[model samples]
Target: MTKIKICGLMTIEDIDAVNQAKPDFAGFIFAGGRHHIDLDQAIKLREHLDPRIISVGVFVDAPIEEILKAVNSGAISIVQLHGNESEEVVDYLHDKNIKVIQVFNPTDEKFNTGADYTMLDSDSGEILDWKNLLIIPDILAGSINSANVDKAIKIVKPKIIDVSRGVETNGKKDINKIRQIVNEVHNS
Candidate 1:
């Protein structure tokens, strides 16, 4: 089955909606940026989530110490490195029994060999080449919506699919849209 992951969740409401949707993974951004969430907030959200759903912490080029802090805080079971982190970092985390996901911007080509999963996203919500990723077991992101999701999935057949801005309407996530995307992924 193609797992679905919803990223950049920022509120209790968002968490509630995502939980209702029952995606395989719910991502919380912990790195310093617009989508960032503090440890306390993430911990509170984590506590409310069903254990069946995996909690993922999104980070970008953070030091191992900082990543460890997130793990210890109960913010995440999986770590997603969205910046220029090294393979050694992925290896070290895996050694500690932490699953590591590596994110690749559409233009990056140096694939890290040790990551548990690889995710492809556009810098902006623009579409990118899905064909180039056909061989990789990855998560497809960037401008993915109910309309184009089937096409992307048919071409890439990723192990998982992720969406953030694509599932939102009027700057907020729409439950109907989330359902549509999830349904389309499963049906396709």
Candidate 2:
């Protein structure tokens, strides 16, 4: 079965919604962006998160020490690298028993990051050619929502379907949308 992931969780409200919706994974952005949250906030939010939902820490070229700090805080169990991190970083994280999701573009010729999972993200929510994709992504994430989630699961057939802006309203996570998308993915 394909699992669901709701990303870019920022507030305690977001944590509560995901806890109620019960996605397989919940993402917290450490990377600077509209969804970015500091370590302190992430730790607190993680405390409120459902124990069943795995925490994934998103980073963009962040120092290993910072990543370790977040993991040590018990806020993040998995790491998603969105930058040009070296393979050594992936291996190092694995040594620490942390699963890694290495992000890549559909156009990238090579994807030998050797991380636990490879996620394809356009970053602008642009849907690319799923049929022509060279690799079968472990996680498919780009403009995924309730409307197209079924089609994505049929085509990409990824192990996990990740969403952020798709299940939100006014730049915040909407519980109804989260439940809708989660139901769609699981039922599909």
Which pairs of residues have clashing backbones in candidate 1? none
Q: Write the residue-wise lDDT of candidate 2 on 56-90 in tens digits.
A: 99999999999999999999999999998989999
Candidate 1 residues 67-166, lDDT tens each?
9998988879999998999989999999999999998886676778689998888877689778875336578887888888888888888888988888
* Sliding window of 10 residues with minimal summed lDDT for model 1: 128-137
lDDT of 1 at 17: 80
**lDDT of model 2 at position 43:** 93
Worst 10 residues of 2 by lDDT: 122-131
TM values, all candidates = 0.93, 0.97
Q: Which parts of model 1 are misplaced by more than 4 Å?
A: 133-137
Model 1: what TM-score?
Answer: 0.93
Note the Cα lDDT for every prediction shown: 0.84, 0.91
Clashes of each: 0, 0
